[model samples]
Target: MAQNKQKRGPMQFLQFGVIGFANAAIDIGTLNLLLLLFHTDAKGLLLLYNTIAYTLAVANSYYWNVIITFKRSAEGSNRQRILFIVQGLVSLGVNNLIFLGVNELLQLIGINNWLQYNVAKGMAMFLSFLASFFMVKYVVFRDYGKRYIDEKN
Candidate 1:
C-alpha cells in the first residue's frame, strides 16, 4: 500500500499540474481580456478583474482536482467539499496578495506595465501551485487512518 501510494503521488502531481495550467490560463486570459476591453489604466479595475477570474478558476480547479488528480482521495462527504473550499480560499488569498505586492513593486521600479503584469501573474501562479499542492495533499485529502497506523503496531 505504501508503495502504491508513493506511485500515485507522482501521477497525482502531474494531473494537478495539468489542471492548474488550464485554470491559470483561464484566469490570466480572462483578466487580459477584461483589461483590453475596458481600455482603462486603473489598478483597482485590474484587481477587481483578477478577483473575479480567480474565483472562477478556483471553482474550476476544485472540480477537476477532485475528479482527476485526487480522485482516489476524494470523499463523497459534505465535510470534504467544505474543507476543499477552505483550502482553495487560503490559496486564493496567498496568490492574490503575492500578485499585488509583486506588481506594485515592479511598477515602483519603473518596469513596463505589460511585463510587470505577466511576471507578477507567473510568480503568483507558481507560488500558488506549490501552496495548493501541499494543502490538498496534507490537509484536505490526508489519509488520517494510514498516517496513524503502523505496519508493526
Candidate 2:
C-alpha cells in the first residue's frame, strides 16, 4: 500500500511569492519615502525609518503567510506566534545591517544615493526572503507531531 503525501502545488508557491512581493514593496516603498522626506545625515534617523518600515512589512507578511501562503501546511497553535515574532526581529536586524552596509559601500563607490538606495533595498529583500522562508517553514508552521503518529498508525 502506498502512503499519502502532502505535496505543495504551483499555485501555493505563486501565492507565497505574490505575498512576499507585496511585503517587499511596502518595506522598500516606505523606506524610500522616508529617505526622501528626511535629508539628514544622522544614522539614527536611517535606523528609525528602517525599523518602522520593517515592522509594518513583517506584520503584513506574517498574517498573509499564515492565512494564505502556508495555510495548508500550518499546524501550530498561537504558541508559534512568539517564535515567529522573534524570528522576524532577528531577520529584520540582519536585513537592516546588510542594507546599510550595501548603501554605504555604494556611496563610497560614488554611486548616486537614489540608485544606491533602491539597489540596497532589493538586495536586502532577496536575502531576507530566504531567511524568513526557512524560519517560517521549519519553526512557525512545522508539523505538530501528528505526521509521525499517523504514518505509523
Name the top lDDT candidate: 1
Q: Relative to the unseen true structure, what is the C-alpha lDDT of residue 115 in candidate 1, on a scale of 0 to 100? A: 83
Best model per TM-score: 1
Query: For residues 58-91, what per-residue lDDT tens digits would candidate 1 score against the true structure?
Result: 8898889888887766775787788888988888
Residue-level lDDT of model 2, residues 1-153, one tens digit each, is 122443453555577689988998899889888988885556678778878888889999988988887786665466788888988988898888988889789889999877887898789878887788778777777756755666677
Model 1 root mean square deviation, Cα atoms: 2.5
**After superposition, candidate 1 runs with Cα above 4 Å error:** 145-153
In model 1, what is the error at residue 96, expressed in angstroms?
1.1
Listed per model in order, the count of residue pairs whose N, CA or C atoms clash below 3 Å is: 0, 0
User: What lDDT does the true structure give each of the candidates?
Assistant: 0.82, 0.79
The 10-residue segment with the lowest total lDDT in model 2 = 1-10
